[model samples]
Target: MNINFNSEDAGQIVIGAFALSVPIAFSEESWHLAQTLPLGNMALVVLLSLGFIALFAYQSVFQANVMRRIGVFWLRVAIAYLLTLAVVSVVLIALDKWPMLHQPILALKRTLLIAMPASMGAIIVDSFDKE
Candidate 1:
């Protein structure tokens, strides 16, 4: 079956996924299956790790598309960079749960809380980039 994970509603999908993940991950109910759900302070680290992986993937994909658009133009590069920072930093990261990421990356779950959203957003942009 086809999945529309790349539509305008995809943002809502990511947000909804995060919302569901947070409570289930930290709660004891998750213990019925795996040891973690994907939230809570401890689980945050894993989220961070996943987020980094997602970021790297998104950047690599994004750069390729950006290069295709205006590889030789520094102006485009700067604009893309600033836009990316603006989108990931302000729109998504800074909106709801940035405080959670600002917390010391001392744990797993907390890290994911910060990183996953970053990665997911980046990936979304990458997907939207002209191919």
Candidate 2:
């Protein structure tokens, strides 16, 4: 498939991220998980999220045609993940869950945990309507 990253794609990603993030952001388990989970586990979450994004990007959008549009492929993955991270960060900040000033690591852990599912949502939405 010929995938073009466009404004509508961004909007879809935002909507998808928000759809999954709000529920997870409100979870007490998520809050505590972030506070207690080790840094290594969080690193695994990051890798897992990226892996899923890359897999989907290759299967649904790039379709083994990535070499020709490497920039667009990377852009889609980056935008989906980063946009979801931004959305997750805003939600956590509004909920007072992100204490960046005092406990930056915990805050980052929370964001990464939440971004996993949220970024998955974003990628799924990005793949919509492409046959």
Candidate 3:
């Protein structure tokens, strides 16, 4: 399958990301967990998020033809993850939960925790328009 990622894909990713991010971003439990979870766990979460995205994209979007279109595969994954991260960060910043200046680590943890689900939403949405 040949994947042509364009502005439409980006828009879908952002919408999908925002769709799931809002609820998780507002959750008090997530806020508390972000503060309490150790940095190592946060790192694990990041890895898990990327792993799931790659797996899903390969199976559902790329259809396991990664060798044929390695660049497109990585590009889709990168866009989905990065766009979701941006959406989550914006939501957190708007809610005053992202204290980047005061505690950058905490802010990043919170963003990562939320981005996990948001990125899934993005990948799923991106797959919807595929042939």
- Ten residues in a row with the worst lDDT in model 3? 1-10
Off by over 4 Å in 1: 1-103, 106-111
Winner by TM-score: 3
Between candidates 1 and 2, the one scoring higher on TM-score is 2
lDDT of 3 by residue, 30-127 (tens): 99999999989999999999999999999988888789788889888998999999999999999999999999989999999999999999888988
- After superposition, which runs of candidate 3 have C-alpha atoms over 4 Å from their true positions? none
Output the worst ten-in-a-row residue range by lDDT, candidate 2: 1-10
Sort order, lDDT high to low: 3, 2, 1
What TM-score does candidate 1 reach? 0.26
**Residue 84 C-alpha lDDT in model 2:** 93
Using lDDT as the measure, name the better of candidate 1 and candidate 2.
2
TM-score of each: 0.26, 0.93, 0.95
Per candidate, the number of residue pairs that clash is: 12, 0, 0
Q: Cα miss at 31, model 2 (Å)?
A: 0.7
User: How displaced is residue 113 in candidate 1, in Å?
Assistant: 2.1
Model 2 TM-score is: 0.93
- 1-131 per-residue lDDT for model 2 (tens digits): 54887898889899889999999999999999999999999999999999999899888877767887889888889889999999999999999999999999989999999999999888898788666
User: What residue runs in model 2 are displaced by over 4 Å at the alpha carbon?
Assistant: none
* Candidate 3: Cα lDDT at 94: 94
lDDT for 28 (candidate 3): 94
The root-mean-square deviation over C-alpha atoms between each candidate and the true structure, in angstroms, is 10.1, 1.3, 1.0
lDDT of each: 0.38, 0.91, 0.92
